[model samples]
Target: TDIPHFSTTDWTWAKGALQTVDRPYGPLLNLLHHGIGSTHVCHHINPRIPHYNAWYASALLKNNFPDLVRYDSTPIHKALWRIATRCTVVSQRGGIDGYFYQPKPSI
Candidate 1:
């Protein structure tokens, strides 16, 4: 299957709660959990920290290792649309060992 990949929106309380639940529950809970949205990357890096403190940890990571961290500042809706429309295929080219995807080339 061709899965779409895009940057995650900033973590907020509503976003964090939504991440804890399944996708179907997102729309209803996103606003309420928006604060937790951005700390996702931090959580993945260090699960020991509680969600409430993930944001602070994420900030430290971003500051210390900006290039290493995959922090996306895009708005959630816009990032979704961009991925849906542009990321159509996944491929691994020669010399590139890992699987990855890119947007379709412009005309």
Candidate 2:
């Protein structure tokens, strides 16, 4: 199922929601902040949180948004976990300034 996949827009939405004031799933966000790393790392250790909002969106589609206790069991979540696990290699020497993206040069 090519469920539209996730895009940059989806990432924006997740970022916005993560910074919201509600703080319903605060711990999850914290875990993502502390446990997860860059997109490349997440792509291997676990791309779940990266695509976390997608599952949220999915639940909303099924009218089970509020019922979604967590996303740890979802495929997207597992994929993200795997990505994160593999991305973090201490032996790998590289810059952490922006592993997943680069900021545009200032004008």
Alpha-carbon runs more than 4 Å astray in model 2: 1-14, 18-77, 89-107
Please list the residue runs of candidate 1 whose C-alpha ends up more than 4 Å from where it truly belongs after superposition. Answer: 1-31, 104-107
Best candidate, TM-score: 1
TM-score of candidate 1 relative to the true fold? 0.59
Error of 1 at 49 (Å): 1.7
Worst 10 residues of 2 by lDDT: 16-25
Q: Please, what are the lDDT tens digits per residue for candidate 2 over residues 1-107?
A: 10122244444544433321111234565466542322222223224554544444444533643332223333445545555554332221254211232223355
Instruction: Give lDDT for model 1.
Output: 0.54
Native-referenced Cα lDDT, model 2: 0.34
Cα error of candidate 2 at position 78, Å:
3.5
Query: What tens-digit string does per-residue lDDT give for candidate 1 at 6-93?
Result: 2254344433432321122144344467445556556656668876676578778779967555545556566667878898666665
